[model samples]
Target: MIKVLIVDDIPETRNHLTKLLSVDSEIDVAGTAGSGEEAIRVAMELRPDVIVMDINMPGMDGVAAAEIVSQRLPTSPIIMMSVHGEAEQLRRAIAAGAREFLVKPFSADEFSTTIKRVYERELGRREQLQAITPAPSGPQEPGSAEEDHQVVAVFSPKGGAGRTTIAANLALALMSETGGRVCLVDANLQFGDVGVLLNLNPKNRSILDAIEGGEPDADLLESVVVDHSTGIRVLLAPPSPEGADLVTPTYLRKIIDLLRVTHDWVVVDLPPALTDHTLGIMDAADQIVVLSALEITTIKNVRLFLEVADQLEYDRSKLRLVINRSDTAQGIRISDVEASIRRPVDGTVVSDGRLAVLAVNRGVPFVVSHPEAALSRDITRLARTLAGEPSTSASTEKPKKGLFARR
Candidate 1:
């Protein structure tokens, strides 16, 4: 049974919640508290699987109580209840380490689902930590290679360059080409679109769970990631931007180190900026695919990124340049783009605006829906190249009924 602690200042609210939760056979009301301070004390004693606390409690608010409880019992998940759905409240709740948030006047179904998801997520995290606590042999040192795993980071210095789209498709194609041993990480912590692109529900569990769990081992990392239908394991970003601050560069490195041990290939979809977090991932990547469009501004940003890569002494051979929308009739040839960036274009994905939009909206990748389309063929060939297999030239087939074919 799932043990839940409900906290609210009002007696009626607490009783109502308890009654609503009691209808579910799987849930048990472990205890109830009238204020944030009382809730913290009760939580410490009860150690419930899930804590549902109201945000507007007198004296001590839900945010303060949540922060304390989270620090004290990192394994237990907190669900913040608020009447206001403002962004600030959501941010505060996430900052206080609440795993889930619910607005007031929610249905019984919503309440039950939130409790169960939080409970299961907490249980999984604890079990994972216990399973990987390094036996009597002691913890393994860093840089100890379990096996040879390739890490690929898909990046773009400019936003709207379709980096997330390319990254998702590349992961799918890699899975298809390599017999399904691929992991895709959404490193765009603030606003990652990988979950939306692949149609995955990124709630309750994310990369933040792994990082906040202290030290992540292979089992811990595996437990946090969600497996997609395309045979790709996804480490989704935090559900809100406030949760991103919890993930530091050091934590990301540790997560990647653990992930590389379990998967054959790790594909990271990065944010547009080269923050310390992004740099940390790039430092571990075996290959970096830089994406750019045909626009002058995008090409300029790519050139600047190339210069920075040189300054950082990155291996030029490991950095591959991909020109998205390569077939656009923007008067600027692919050769001109390469000349501007001072690097040869390793791959090019043809433009298919309608298909791309449709795929994103329908939560299906074009590579799966339109495998025969020119755009899909390009992604497939690019995947082969990244996988160290010989790839044929881009397909010349034009997708029928192409509209607004610009990246």
Candidate 2:
């Protein structure tokens, strides 16, 4: 039987929900509370299988209390009920660790079904996480280090340069090529596309979760980071645009440091502008793959950014210039880009408009869905080159000093 706790500010509503849930033979209304504070106290005592909560309450609001309950009794899933079905309300509830949301006038059947569904989903998520996490082996021995612990930041000076897309695909490609743990961090806090590209719709888990939870560490990261099908872990950006304000440069730098400790390749999809947050990521990365396109404006921005890199005292070898959609532009070719930037093009990704569209629409990286395509091959070659593998990549850099490989 699924033991449930119904929490609502209204006594009638709490009783009504109890009666509604009592209809299901498999559900047991073990407890009910009239306020958020009482709800947390009762929830802790009962430790029910699920907690159905009203979003608004006097004193401590449901979202606030739910956050506490979620941390204390993480195994017990929460279903938030709100009279208003606004997107912001739902987002708030989800960010507070709600597993499901129900509009105020939901039917008994819908409530019961939602309760069962959330329970099942949470169980499955826990099981999958257990399988992914290795057994605890205590502290590491002296001189021990994680192999393939490298940080690569995928950055661009201007927007619409396919920086996020490249970061996503490159992360997956790195995992496929090296058989290592690759984590894709969507550092574009305001408007991140990593989750959409990877088709990951996690529940209340983002980089914000780790930052807000306090000092960043591996244990904290494992809780917030979601796993991709191809064995790549992802630390997504905030759920809402305003939530980006909470993610600071210091938090981002710490996150990157902690991530590189456990992960083989930390591929950070940096924000477009040259901000403090982006600079922090650059400071952590072993290589900075600066993505540009074959457009005149894009090339101009790339040149200007390179001068900034020099001013920051960044070694030229630490940066690699990559041209996306290399053959699409009318007049500007790779050689022109190289000449304009006054640097050798380390890598190039050819465009396939139709396939790229299909991949994005389908929410799968082209490298994973269409590995045989020319686009996928280019990404794979680039991955190997960055991984320090001796491959015949079309890199025009010197043989001895090829594009700042980590290995």
Candidate 3:
């Protein structure tokens, strides 16, 4: 059950809110506080799962108290309560570490839903982190940097087809299943957001520096990677936007070769525009996932990219299509998508705006925050499929049982 603390100076409001929340079986009102100071004391003492705090309490305002409570107990999610949903107050509440906002007139359903989401998000995060880090096999290659990793680059010819999201969630899924060393490289240097989405510190170390300083070995390259709470490592792009273009194809090739020797899986998120670096990454990839949407423009681009890959003698067998945002509500059907691309979409992510927005805004992966979501489930399945785990069903024209089909 989610332990909630109702923090408000007004007794009537506090009792009403507590009674409203008590109706939900999953929620438990730990206690009530009439002042911000009292709320802080309760939060520190009781360590509730969530705090429904009022904005205008005496001694300390809700925002200030939230900031203190949040610091004291970083694990608990704060939900700010306000008389009005004023834009400025809401902004302040968020900045003060409030995960969500509830207006004074919020219905029981609204309050309950927000509380449940916050609770689930936290619980899911803990589970995901636990899922990723397992015992190492033998000992890590000590001073043996070359024997450690496999770098897989994910590239597509088109943009707005969910490349970064794919790379981020795929990394999570891979790490969760394999419990091995997995690193995601945000090679889309200009607009790289893998770090931001994953809540990583944008450290100075990046692929650019490694490349510029000549082909560095695994020992030197290890300094650049940032390890997430979920155990996936990442080498972020440079903070400056203009710096991306400076990286040459030769530079990327060297980085991939080095990574392949060191990490278990090196997933790179290539930019939409095919530069020399993109081609080099594709050449080095064990698997290349081409992300496309069910749009005419994206389909046309996919066809063009396939032709280019054929001309360039890239592995057609390894190239796979992934259709993102595949909602039946959309006009574009799956048949139309396959007919245009001349290939079956490897997988489809279901429409989930709530999960997507929350994950992005909170800098957490959806698979980690809301694993039960359709998008998360599909992404996890895709990851398992890529890891050489056979699917239960096969795509043969004649029905055939896959390796793991029920017998």
- Tell me each candidate's TM-score: 0.61, 0.63, 0.63
Please, what is the whole-model Cα lDDT of each candidate in the order they appear?
Answer: 0.80, 0.81, 0.75
**Number of clashing pairs, model 2?**
0
Look at candidate 2 and tell me the lDDT of residue 138. 22
The parts of candidate 3 lying over 4 Å away from their true place are 1-128, 132-149, 389-407
Q: CA lDDT of 327 in candidate 1?
A: 84
Off by over 4 Å in 2: 1-144, 389-407
Residue 90 local lDDT, model 2? 98
Task: Write one digit per residue (lDDT tens) for candidate 3, span 191-240.
Answer: 78886787554335676666556665576677666666566778888777
On the 0 to 100 scale, the lDDT of residue 142 in model 3 is 51
Q: Candidate 3, overall lDDT?
A: 0.75
lDDT of 1: 0.80
lDDT order of candidates, best first? 2, 1, 3
For candidate 2, the 10 contiguous residues with the lowest summed lDDT are 393-402
State each candidate's clash count.
Answer: 0, 0, 8
Off by over 4 Å in 1: 1-147, 389-407
